[model samples]
Target: MTTEKLFKVNGVELWAETFGDAADPAVLLIHGASASMLWWETAFCAKLAARGRYVIRYDQRDTGRSTTYPVGEPPYAMSDLAADAIGLLDALGVERAHVVAQSMSGGTGLHLGVDHASRVASLTFVSTTTGDDELPPPSDDFPRFSTPDFGDSAAVEEYVVRAIEAESAGVFDEAAARVLVRSDIARATNFEASLTNHYAMKFDGPQGGGFGELTMPVLVVHGSRDPVFPLAHGQALRDAVPGGKLVVIEGAGHGIPEPLWEPFLAALVEQTDAR
Candidate 1:
């Protein structure tokens, strides 16, 4: 079924989609930079809902329909982003949740699970990293995306829309892709900028050390075909986190494609429900 839902965090009107029973054990789904809830495969979210788990996927501040950060307010850090996640959980009165994050959001989720274990029941790290040194440079075949010169807002949106529309799923059609990509970049600029500052502040500060503190079960999932963040990052996350299991998808890419949804969700649901 179609879903439209909203919540308030730090007095900001945060938007999200609710799937599954609200009363059931909750799974808080976080997206990567430049992504709203649009990145998730619909079938996967619905399947988790069907299995009696409350799947809450939200628009991080500055993305989707959520409220944007104020102009003069302090820029957001990785901690700030993690705080936003916690704020959402607190706002909903959710004591603990299964946290699933992909790409850049993986770092933020790692911060949360290690620092605030009370809030994370389990962690699913997908196409993600814990800021490890084991990450190799991107391969020659992969398109280098998100450089400092991504061009102006409109240009970046146009490029991203055109690029993602060409993906196999046909999910983000031309028109829909434009709206989602354009709006996401425009709204989330400040928060994303803040994230950049955070990156600079802690560049080489430490790598995934907090994983040693994470006691909860974690499932690290990645795609062999993913060009952006290769399978090595996944392996590193699994290694850093104690007892973490790595599940590699054969044909999957940077984004979780529909072809791998079954295995991804099965692995995700299994780990989330197991412990």
Candidate 2:
């Protein structure tokens, strides 16, 4: 069964969707930056739930069909985003839930693990960066595409074409690339502050309060081909947390839903069982 609901946190009405049985153990999946809960990948989430887990995916304030921050409002930090997780749990009446977060959203799980250990059953960080500082500089190959300097139609069109070609050569899927780039561009245009808020991981703080405090069984999953975040970030997370398991999915890139979906499900299942 599935249901869509709305709940408020910090004056923002967040949208959430729930899947599977309520009687089953709950697994909360948080998507990466600039992405909606759809980033969780429907197939993966559905298959996991079919294995007898209650899964929840939601918009993180400004993404997808969620509430928007008002103009002139102060920026939201990783901690504030963490609070939204807590609010979701409370609204759902889930005392403790396993957390599966990717990219920037990994910090949300970490924050909850640090501040409210009792509320979290386990954590899975995927395509995650350890710290913004330790990250290897952006891949040199992605020069014009990575830059935010695409100032016009011609530059933007060329940038999108290049990105698609890079994603897969010989196919040149301009239609697919246009859809993705357009969605991203629309998000940035509609909610500039929220986009800025999503990128503001600097608030993750020094050492991020240390993973030593997370007593729950933790899983760190990363892909070697992931460009946005370096593999070293996964290693750092594993090193910091006691008994943390790291799963390196081969050939998977920044997006976990595609090439890495199976391993992602397996790692999540193992971590949930351990927790």
Candidate 3:
């Protein structure tokens, strides 16, 4: 079962949902840029909860039912996003949590692990790159996606479906993607803002030290066929953090598709369980 609520953090309202027992170990799921908690499907959260984890998935600022900024003028920086996570934990009465982040939010996780190390138990980064200039650029085959007409719900849903097909290696589910996108558009506070504002935010590096300063257990999850960051990025990310581990999803692209959920879950549970 999932419990949804609103919390006042950093003078803005954030909508969030939680699964399983509050007394269990907590896992905070941060979605990629231009995404809401909907990307972290309910079934996935339920499975994690069944493994004795308290799962939390939320709408970041300008996404889902949370507060929204104007379409092209987001007022907060990326570090503010990291601070919002800490404020959320305080509101939930959780002293420490396992942090799981994907794409752009991976930097946010690094910030928490370095600057706010006391609040995080472990860090799991998915399909993201470390800000290393030496990393190879995105593959030439990377998807060239189109923007949606936000006023037309059908058009927006179709856009999402096309994006999923392009991003996944061979596990795109059109029906499921349509269903999820429809709900996402219908419930979002300002769907257009959610999709556009995140891209404009500036990222300030960790306030303390860098990834090498992280003392918590770090796990990197990447797809074998990821076009954006590629497997090499994941390898380098793991190498940067002390004692970091990498889990590559064979035949997967940038995101964790449904078929690969079990393996990803196993890896996540194992990482979070580490001392």
Best by TM-score: 3
Query: For model 2, what is the C-alpha lDDT against the true structure?
Result: 0.72
Query: How displaced is residue 115 in candidate 3, in Å?
Result: 0.8
Top model number, lDDT:
3
What local lDDT score does residue 115 receive in model 3, on the 0 to 100 scale? 90
lDDT of 2 by residue, 15-67 (tens): 88888987888999998775666556566778888888999998886676676
Task: Provide the lowest-lDDT 10-residue window in model 3.
Answer: 141-150
Model 1 lDDT tens row, 183-219:
5565564534433333342222113357777889988
Arrange candidates by lDDT, descending: 3, 2, 1
TM match of model 2 to true structure: 0.82
Per-prediction TM-score: 0.80, 0.82, 0.97
Candidate 2 deviant stretches above 4 angstroms: 70-74, 132-135, 144-194, 200-208
Model 1, CA-based lDDT: 0.71
Between candidates 1 and 3, the lDDT winner: 3
- Residue pairs with backbone overlap in model 3: none
